[model samples]
Target chain A: MRTIFYISDGTALTAEAFGRAMLSMFPLKVVHKTLAFIDTEAKATAAVNKINQAYADSGERPVIFHTFVSIDIKRIIMSSQGSCYDFLDYFVTPLSKELGIPAQPKTHRTHGIQEDTGVRENYDFRIDAVNYSLANDDGSNVANYDEADIILLGVSRTGKTPTSLYLALHYGIKAANYPLTEDDNMENLQLPKVLKPHRHKIFGLTLDPQRLHEIRSKRREGSTYASLPQCRFELQEVEKMYRREAIPFLDSTRFSVEEIAAKILAETNIERHRF
Target chain B: MRTIFYISDGTALTAEAFGRAMLSMFPLKVVHKTLAFIDTEAKATAAVNKINQAYADSGERPVIFHTFVSIDIKRIIMSSQGSCYDFLDYFVTPLSKELGIPAQPKTHRTHGIQEDTGVRENYDFRIDAVNYSLANDDGSNVANYDEADIILLGVSRTGKTPTSLYLALHYGIKAANYPLTEDDNMENLQLPKVLKPHRHKIFGLTLDPQRLHEIRSKRREGSTYASLPQCRFELQEVEKMYRREAIPFLDSTRFSVEEIAAKILAETNIERHRF
Candidate 1:
């Protein structure tokens, strides 16, 4: 296997994003390493030594995806025995020309608190959203639904919790989820009375019956809740209620949290509090 | 102000990451739009119309950062008035040569459930980690500490919760956090008895007293818990305990959750469950 390095002066998150996106096209296994906060010349020199060692050990040039603000530090990294790709550097000139402004590169601007204004108000939005989502998770705090940007409705194990947290963490969207369980009378389901007034903000998630069965089986083995027939029955009733109530929903059986959140955002008009 | 668009046949997450990293170098304000799941020609044409309308409205060429697996849809987007940059396409040939494999373009492979093996086992790790973190949040379930990859210890409002969730969601690491409050005896702080057995997995978070005061003040307007003296005393005691116990710690006052998570991963040897 080959070595892939994501190195940057800051968090190197963008470098990881770039490398992962590029490598998804290739069906190969590789080792992953990240050297973050490499802001000093000494640290950059040490990183070059590691890159050279990986090349020596693997007998193949390591693929380096890096973003750096300091020219001196980046020069050291470019001198390493690796095929370095700096996506940000490659696009900077053309982007500057198109925007008619020179690029003022700065460390920590990509994934740092300083990216927001000095007050860090935008960063606060994310923390606040996370707190809100946690406090409102799983119908624990229905009284706070009016403060939510969106509410997620789903049966148990249909992926409402992770989706809600992802929306809060990534987009600073206050997403509270309510799980539809036996308590909701799955045999004849209706939108819970508490959720009726906030129906406009509700989004539903459903999964394939087989998928739901597999998921629940891992939690409560051999129970009716983990049986295929029970899973099918619950899903059929919940989905019917979705249509009857005219609530928008997604079958999240085959989607990652990122895909589900993006689909919801694309379909809904909820405002994202963070860029 | 100019307009910027992130368009992709998939979730458009990679495009957004690329665009945000590149734009952070320049001090420019622009409107942002994302066109996700544009896998069809009709959707591509509609996206182009939106891009062209934005150009006309702003009297400036819109900056488009796009990724697409469909050549036909990408062609339609290229014909739009916006200046498009495809970083994935730009880096493909070089990366392909370095890896000795031809690029296999596929939609939904980048940010979809299909990124994992067909079993979706890696996707399950993320969801499982999220559930674990939620179950163990804020010292709620101390008996499960042995299962945590890391246990974050911090005083109230020092950013333990968001950091824990970020570690779980992004890296698939089980991060359980315990809060050090007045209940911990701020005057004479010590590592709780329950955490002593898992000392190797402990990471401490501390914030500037001023920042903590501001954060707590928002939740409680005129209380001693939100007072500067109280904040200072609590943080001072916590830092003393961390050093006395020889625990690794961070002053997270100047970092975002991403930065804090990256810093923790850099300092620790905890195995990341996701790539």
Candidate 2:
């Protein structure tokens, strides 16, 4: 029954995310509204009125979350008859003092098109990594094995492709994944020719057979490939390969793509190229 | 010469991003530190001392950015000698008032494993879209054109792949991209047979010839394909094809992947499935 207002001078993605994170802790059904691009005084005033109206209607104060860079607009928002939390107002003065420089507040500059030429190189790096991941996906373009930062080896439907893409997209890491086939499993789980030279850069993904069975069943219903015994066999063989090759492996059953990416980066000691 | 500290009870990504955005406004070279997993009073005390030490050493107050769910830890951080800004303290009371519920401060629950089953469906949607983008990248598997939410058409290296991946990764939109080849251009700007049926869902991307040349040359140097004339001819023909086919096009010469993705979503009226 509560209204949560997110106000921002920019994209308000961070405000939205932080607000959701904090609000989810309480067991309540809440109405969330986001007012982005609130750079003008008139817009700020409009927001204040909307918030006050909500408070009056519900007989409860609306919680206003804002990340505004303009002191003037922030003052107008702070004057609203709601529970006002301004991100910049609480920190800018102290930051100015600590840095020995005055704050130059710019509207919509946080997540907007960057005029900072310094971030271009990093942006290009990430784009290149993303392209590399696509090109080398599923071991299709193994000719460029030498350029990969890490090679993920797993059986079918073990989250190799998504993990690789997440790593590339988020960390700018050149990740390639090779699917371990049934032939490899039957042939004593030896490393493929293309992957042998990149042994040091290889990581494996493992999961419980039951979970794998559930995932594969959804993709290929009533098929032998998706059967429980087939999943169990594949997982056992992959674990054997990982142990035999001394490749670090992770069980991706309970982990999200974010967690999987963090683990891969941390385990491999790969330095993330931040933008 | 100042120190910037990002303290959080969770992953600290928001705290870090907010700190960076705010710090970039001030022209100062600041040393950045992230103290994550600050869920305990002991951790908060240690962070306070660390902030004090940095302040004492530099003779400048450190700027501490925090998103603490716990009031006790927030109090400890606010008591530090540095300039402390706690995201929760300024808003939690009002949010409680607005929601008609008490704030249950939990640490590390924001970005950790989700206990919410409702989000699980959306997560699967995103993963499926990512797989679709990878499978359909660069016209590799265009057989599923009927299933796509949107199909992007562009020449090679016109940023088709990255944009498609971004759309899929962020919004769970089943985006498939087809590269406009020379054959399609030489055939009197005709649409490819594979793309003719799904013309309504197609979007075109165009960029400067020089930028295209620069990107292609890096991939395949010293070739007619990467020559200026080739890039110019291809770009000119693609624009002609876009006009002939009546495909909505975007000039992606200077936009970042993030900007391009947003533009694509907005122009196509494609609903973004937020996480």
- Complex DockQ, candidate 1: 0.76
Question: Which stretches of candidate 1 lie above 4 Å from their native place?
Answer: A115-119, B115-119
Q: Score the docking of each candidate (DockQ).
A: 0.76, 0.35
- For all candidates in order, the CA lDDT equals 0.91, 0.78
Q: Pick the candidate with the highest TM-score.
A: 1
- Could you tell me which 10 consecutive residues in candidate 2 chain B have the lowest summed lDDT? B106-115
lDDT measured at residue B83 in model 1 versus the true structure, 0 to 100: 97
For residues B1-275, could you state the per-residue lDDT of candidate 1 as single tens digits? Answer: 78999999999999999999988888877888999999999999999999999988889899999999988999999999999999988999988898898998863267776634542777889889999999999999999998999999999889999999999999989999999878878888989999999999999999999989999999997899999999999999999999999999999998889999999999999888665
Worst 10 residues of 2 chain A by lDDT: A106-115
Model 1 chain A is weakest, by summed lDDT over 10 consecutive residues, at A111-120
